[model samples]
Target: MSDANWKVAAERDLMSLGGRPRLFESGSGSYVTDDAGREHLDFLGGIAVNSLGHAHPVFVSAVAEQAAKLAHVSNLFASQPQLDLAARLKRLAGTGEDGRVFLANAGSEANETALKLARLHGNPRGKTAILSLAGAFHGRSIGALSITPKAAYQDPFAPLLPDTRTIEPTLDALEHAFAADDVAAIFIEPIQGEAGVRELPDGFLARARELTRRHDALLILDEVQTGSGRTGEWFAFQLPGMLPDGELPDAVTFAKAVGAGFPLGGLITFGRASDLFAPGMHNSTFGGNPLASHVADRVLAHVEDEGLLANVTRRGAQLREAVSALPGVSGTRGAGLLIGIALERPIAADVVAHALDGGLIVNAPAPDTIRIAPAFTVGDPEIEDFIRRFGDALNAASQSSETTA
Candidate 1:
């Protein structure tokens, strides 16, 4: 069938989220081939989920082997892979022996699990308020959405979980919110991915840590977009200067790259936070199943073994440096392989469309920001290809803007 036919069928059959999506037949490494047989460089990396890129040997092998051996045993049973992954996630989060893990199906589920933890901790003390930054994007579930603070995404689903508030991302705002002593927890993204990859103000995290600790509230860092070595660290909270030495968040939610495109997510809790969830309090039938657990564990191992974190750091710097020199570019934000290109004009959508036409894939999270979160395995070749294609796209967008003007 023709690409046009596929698109027409998609429009007819699929729900209209943002219109019909581009039809891609396959992908390998840093590129995806559309149904029309055009290969596009995948700089978005499935929104930072494809850690080793598409169809990595390690990822495929793990999935196949685990499926053949064992896939689903439900939550009632425990598997080696499940236990191993839990231990590994605890280590990665620096949660020590007191840490515990709750596996789930996606970022939304992970955040929901974190929400339950907050309730478990707060209900006894009559603390029910939940705080999130103004521009934060946690997830779309009712519980997660309540803390996300986006009007467009939340307004449609009115009467959300109560007592949720969006506050400014400032020290004073945090202080004011907690002064009431009603906040059960505060959800923060080390780097706000949906808010155009905006990082929190310097020292904001450490200060939040102090405030939450003082108020006896849980500090949950949503690392769904920045975890699994995306920020050149095991977790964003572990990044240098993100938190003081020997300091840690009460709990951390993770997904995306940890599964390397597999539908897997989890919440890791530290210290007393780990003990809050009683066994019967929460559960998922498919969570921590053998297949997803094995695959996620292997993905994390591959990222560590292949030294992809270093690659993320190095390639991120290179991509930012090259992109900054391009026409129409104002600057770049984000760390490691997750980056947001700021445009001189609010033409990021046009640039993204041009980039797609030029056989490169990117997304405009905001009017003036183009987000690029390529595979952690990207190296010089991928970087060079991206520069060449993206440069052409920028030039074309600039020319079109001039013509329109």
Candidate 2:
């Protein structure tokens, strides 16, 4: 609220890399303003959370109106919004008749709920192992962290969930792991987020689904960063699978875009697995509350009405092509707006800082990979602006790299 408060945040309460973060006061469509009154074009879209961008009239009204009416109601009595949101998500998640939904607060919480469901579904049998892909980033919590591939985060918190295993995400590797008898679930992100937006080899998901089925393991798709039209498709796996089985993942874990920046996560389950959890098996007091549910409902409705899926397809390719043609940029990988640019020079951090300095907000998750996850509402003008500025920043970074080398 105050600069003093922002200054205090830098000193205490912030975790590592947490201090000195942007002190923003407000945001509008594809833009945010700092406490200092500096406005920056929001290309990052809160790391793929603000699908409609900050303070969209619809989103603002939804939050404001919902806040005024009923903010939160526990899971005891039925809330229409909660049920409606669940029904919408269940349908979207491909859960059809046997579908069930579980709500949580964030990506990690959602994945944790999925893990519990897997364990519960495998109740009659002993299935503990969760096979995760390499270079994965599920979330910050222990359960999700256990399956994540980044050792830098995991090494500090030694003794994560045992029976957790990692594989190369190759067909043979996945088959080998699924050959085991005790695997409860195989968790994967359709597009690995913190792992630099790496897409799994084509058909990997379909293959994993089949392998999991054969081994009685659940195929969990962690679409926290990949869902809600980020990948142009309703879900990334919808693209006809190149995998042997060509099937859908059994469970879908969604978070980032579910509530359109309101912090909602849900798990969609299919098959008889939906019956695994009974009364008190699992619950979240704040989960499926009225406010979040309303927002979730509106977000989905808005996505469809606004034709964001088609826009994501068009603009994502434009952004990718523009970045690829820029000097010092080698290539781009990823589907839709969830793109990662591979810079010829390892100046991604410098480019990010420069882009921010140039009134653009983008981030680099690795030394050479710059991620561009703009809001789905990003228009033609903003996309062009981002490319022009981003290319300039990349040029500047390249020049600096040349000087340094």
Highest TM-score scorer:
1
Q: List model 1 lDDT by residue over 294-324, tens digit each.
A: 9999999988887888888988999999999
Q: Write the per-residue lDDT of candidate 2 for residues 243-268, one digit (tens) a residue.
A: 34335667888888767789898888
Clashes of each: 0, 2
10 residues in a row with least lDDT, candidate 1: 14-23
Query: What TM-score goes with each of the models?
Result: 0.98, 0.95
Residue 290's lDDT in candidate 2: 92
- What's the CA RMSD of model 2 in angstroms? 1.9
Scored by CA lDDT, what does every candidate get? 0.92, 0.83
